[model samples]
Target: MPAKKPFALRLDEKMMQAVEKWAADEFRSTNGQIEWLIHEALKKAGRLKDTKEGGRMKDEG
Candidate 1:
């Protein structure tokens, strides 16, 4: 697994409430929703790498 990084985020009350509701509807935690949002945005912007063989992980002997 890749190392996880920590950062601070600020959201307005209205946006935060919307995200919280959406997260519940999707059955994902708030943090997960935020991560998903970021990932999707990056992918939409063509900044995410394509899934390929190199992206797969192999078990070590």
Candidate 2:
């Protein structure tokens, strides 16, 4: 696992509730769900490059 940095995140009350519900449905914590969502979006957009070591962002020139 890579190091994780903590940061403050503001979300609308309703949206937060929805995310919490979705997370429970998926048997994951809200934070994990958020991370998974971000990972999926990045993969879909070709932002996440897979390396021999594993999934990691490509190095910038």
lDDT of 1 by residue, 7-50 (tens): 99999999999999999999999999999898778867877666
Please estimate how well model 2 matches the true structure, expressed as its whole-model Cα lDDT.
Answer: 0.82
Candidate 2 on 1-61: residue-level lDDT in tens? Answer: 5799999999999999999999999999999999888888887887865653345444321
Query: What stretches of model 2 exceed 4 Å from their correct place?
Result: 52-61
Task: Go through the candidates in order and give the clash count of each.
Answer: 0, 0
TM-score of every prediction relative to native: 0.79, 0.79
Estimate the TM-score for candidate 2.
Answer: 0.79
CA lDDT, every prediction? 0.82, 0.82
Q: What shift in Å separates residue 50 of candidate 1 from its native position after superposition?
A: 3.0
What's the TM for model 1? 0.79
